[model samples]
Target: AQTVTQSQPEMSVQEAETVTLSCTYDTSENNYYLFWYKQPPSRQMILVIRQEAYKQQNATENRFSVNFQKAAKSFSLKISDSQLGDTAMYFCASARGNKLVFGAGTILRVKS
Candidate 1:
C-alpha cells in the first residue's frame, strides 16, 4: 500500500519569511504524481504545485515550489515570502491512476 508521511504536525513562520514543509511517500508505482495542496479556513483544497515522477525538475508556482527527490521518495513544499494567506493545513499527496494517498497534514501558522 502507498503511504504519505508528514512528520511535522504543525509549523510556524513569520510573515514575509520562507518555510519548508517536509513530506515523504512510499509507493510501488513507477509512474506517479506528487502534489502539494493548501487548505485554508474555507476548507478549500487548493493545488499548490505538482511534480511528475519522471521529471527531474521541480515544480514551481509564484512563491510556492517543491523539492522533489525521486530517489529518496521525498517531496517537500517550499513557501517563499510566505504571507498570511499561506497559513493553512498543507497536505502532501501522491496519486497513481485513480487512487490517491495523502499525508497527515502540517498546519502552518504565519505569525505577524
Candidate 2:
C-alpha cells in the first residue's frame, strides 16, 4: 500500500520569492518512485521532479528542488524565484510498481 499527504492545502508566494511545499508518503514496497506533479489551471499535469526510493540524492529541476528524506518518508519541494507562471496545483505522488497514489494536492498562487 502507498499513500501521500500534503499538509498544506493552499500556499501563496510573491513573485521572485521562494516557497516550500511539503509532502509525506508511506509505502510498503521497497522499490518505488516519488514524484511531484504540477497542473496549472485547466492545463495538463506536468512532471516537476522525481526521486527513487533507492537513491540517496535528491532530485532537482531548474529552480525546483526536492528534499527527499528516505528514512522519514518526506519529500518536499522548494521553488526559488517563483513567478506567476508557477501558479498551479502541485500534487505529491507515490508509485509502487503498478499502483499510484496521489495526495490531496496543494494549490499554489504566485502573486505579483
Candidate 3:
C-alpha cells in the first residue's frame, strides 16, 4: 500500500513572504510521479508542481516549486512571495500504475 502524509494540518504566512510546506510518502516502486495540488475556498484542486522519481532536478512553476528528496521519500512545496490569492488547501499526491493516493492535506492562509 502507498500513503502520503502532510504533517502540518494548517499553516499561515504574511503577504509577500515565502513559505514551504512539507510532504512525505511511502512507496515501494522505484518509478512514479509525485504531485502537489492546491484547492482554494471554492473547492477546486489545482496542480502546483510535480516531480518524477527518475529526475534529480526539482520541479518549479513560477512562484511554486518542489524540493523532492527521493531517497528520504519526501516532497515539499515552496511558495514564493505568497499572495492573498495563494490561500488554499494543498494536497500531496502520488501516482503509480493505476493507483493515485493523496494526503490529508494542509490548509494555507495568507494574511494581509
Candidate 4:
C-alpha cells in the first residue's frame, strides 16, 4: 500500500517571494509517478508538476519545481516568485497501476 504524508496543514507566503511545501510517501513499487495537484476555491484539481521514479532529474514548470528524493521517498514543491493567484490547496499524489493515492493537502495562502 502507498501513502502520502503532508506535515504542513497550512502555509502562507508573501507575494513576490518563494515558498516550499513538503511531502513524503511510502511505497514498494519501483516504477511509479509522483504528482502535485493544486485545487483552488473552485475545487478543480490542476496538475502542477510530476516526476517519474526512474527519472533522476527533478520536474519543473515555470516557477514551480519539485525536489524529488527517490531514496528518501520524499517529494516537495517549490514555488518561486509567489503570487496571490497561487493560493490554493496543494495535494501530493502517487500513481501506479491505475490507482492514485493522495495526501490530506496543504492550504497555501499568498499574501500581498
Q: Best-fitting candidate, measured by lDDT?
A: 4
Where does candidate 3 clash, by residue pair? Answer: none
Give TM-scores for every candidate, taking all chains together and pairing residue i with residue i.
0.97, 0.95, 0.97, 0.98
> Which residue ranges in model 3 land beyond 4 Å of their true spot?
none
lDDT (C-alpha, whole model) for all candidates: 0.94, 0.93, 0.94, 0.96
For candidate 4, which ten residues in a row score worst on lDDT? 93-102
Q: For model 3, give the 10-residue run with minimal summed lDDT.
A: 91-100
Q: Which stretches of candidate 2 lie over 4 Å from their true place?
A: none
Model 2, 24-84: lDDT tens digits are: 9998777789899999997899998988889888888999999999889899999999999
lDDT of 2: 0.93
Question: Candidate 1's error at 42, in angstroms?
Answer: 0.7
Candidate 1, poorest ten consecutive residues by summed lDDT: 93-102
- CA-only RMSD, every prediction: 0.6, 0.9, 0.7, 0.6
Residue by residue across 1-112, what tens digits does model 3's lDDT show? 8899999999999999999999999999989999999999999888888888999999999999999999999999999999999999999999978777999999999999
Q: Please, what are the lDDT tens digits per residue for candidate 4 over residues 2-100?
A: 789999999999999999999999998999999999999999999999999999999999999999999999999999999999999999999967989
**Which whole-number lDDT from 0 to 100 does residue 76 have in model 2?**
98
